[model samples]
Target: MSRVSDVYLIAHVEDDVGEAVVTGALEAAGVLGKGPGQIKQHHLLCCSTLDGKVPIVRQLEPELHVDGHSGSIDELKRFLPHLLLVREGHTSAASGQTNVGIAASLASYFGL
Candidate 1:
């Protein structure tokens, strides 16, 4: 987490996730650098609202945005500088100005 300028858990509420559960999961994952209070909880769109997260991603302007949604990562990578898609059976774009990568899980990706 220290490798990046900033991080936030911007998940769509309807992602079948309750805020408390999300906070607990993040806390358990040890990814909440500053703690759950620092999370930017936004409740826009459903779990599949890929583009709905664009604004938060844009505002944060992170060097990399890691997400489990392949489609969102694919599209957001076009604008964001770097992206990490955390899922199985996927690869970054072969060629593009944006930088994209893949990871099997958050623990492995961050070496947590």
Candidate 2:
């Protein structure tokens, strides 16, 4: 891990997705508001579309948004001026992207 940044999660999930999201995934990401990840804010938007995250990002107004989901990157890029696409193999089903600010992994994304 590199220097901890104010991590935030703007996830899109359905209410009945089952399991931890009810109370665990965020904690595992060290996003308990006071933990290793030092997450400043987190939101679980119950929706199937990646575009659901657009409003959250707009409201937060962060300088940069990081995401690996290709479809999401495409949607978010429209609203966010800068987005870091962490390419870790698991990309969106839409297409295998060849352009974007891609990084091999979290560490690489941070230039660690």
Candidate 3:
């Protein structure tokens, strides 16, 4: 099998249909994540191709009030344009949600 290095972006969907879309995108792009089990809150993951680096972007729920957090979605939106988006679903963060997106983008951008 040949593995082509490519950046991956992930976003969490609210419904089964959304999940299907995201999962299909990730699988097609060869991107994987920490899985849903490790996700205590809602978030998204974007990854670059060169070195398999990942960054996690937390999606705030109205209740979590993630906007109040140090790094909110608004902050992330500022950087979204620079990233290649992908979709993924898993059961745990251990699968690679925390740092996949940032790593992937940096790697691809720097040609690492």
Candidate 4:
């Protein structure tokens, strides 16, 4: 029988609130199962944006497996077709880690 591929939707949050949002979404998505293989997630945070969410996804040499190849989200999309943008919230000029229930709402929207 053919193997069923897993779906991955990453939620890059700004702070604790953001992390909580993502955690809730993931849990609500019905318990994450093991992927086809080990998938290492690397979160790169920057301050260029007001919310401090990095737009680029990078691969590290240290995390590379002999059978694995380096590629961006666009490249990965070729293999994993579905893409979902769950949540996106911005912090106010003076607020720290604004309440951005991004992933939670997104996962709900997608019927996760």
Highest TM-score, which number? Answer: 2
Which digits, one per residue and each the tens of the lDDT, describe model 4 over residues 28-104? 55343334332222221222332222133222221211111122322433333233223234221211212211232
After the best TM-score superposition of candidate 4, give how far the Cα of residue 43 lies from its true spot, in angstroms.
Answer: 10
The lDDT leader among the candidates is 1
Report the C-alpha lDDT of model 3 over 1-112, residue by residue, as the tens digit.
0132222234445566776777666556544444332221223443332222223432321211111122333344444333222222321121133322332233343455
Candidate 2 regions off by >4 Å?
Answer: 1-5, 16-22, 35-37, 40-48, 89-100
lDDT score at residue 92, model 1, on the 0-100 scale: 36
Candidate 1 structure quality by residue, lDDT tens digits, 1-112: 4443344567566545565576667667765545443433332223335577777677677777888877777668768877887876544333344387777776766667
> Sorted by lDDT, highest first, which candidate order results?
1, 2, 3, 4
Per-residue lDDT value at 32 in model 3: 46
lDDT of 1 at 47: 38
The per-model lDDT (C-alpha) reads 0.62, 0.59, 0.34, 0.32
Tell me the deviation in Å of residue 9 in model 1. 1.0
TM-score on alpha carbons, each prediction: 0.59, 0.63, 0.26, 0.29
User: How many residue pairs clash in all the candidates, one count each?
Assistant: 0, 0, 32, 1
Q: Which ten-residue region of model 3 has the weakest summed lDDT?
A: 61-70
Candidate 4 deviates by what RMSD?
13.8
Better of 3 and 4 by TM-score: 4
Looking at candidate 3, what is the lDDT of residue 21? 75
Model 2 lDDT, residue 102, Cα: 71
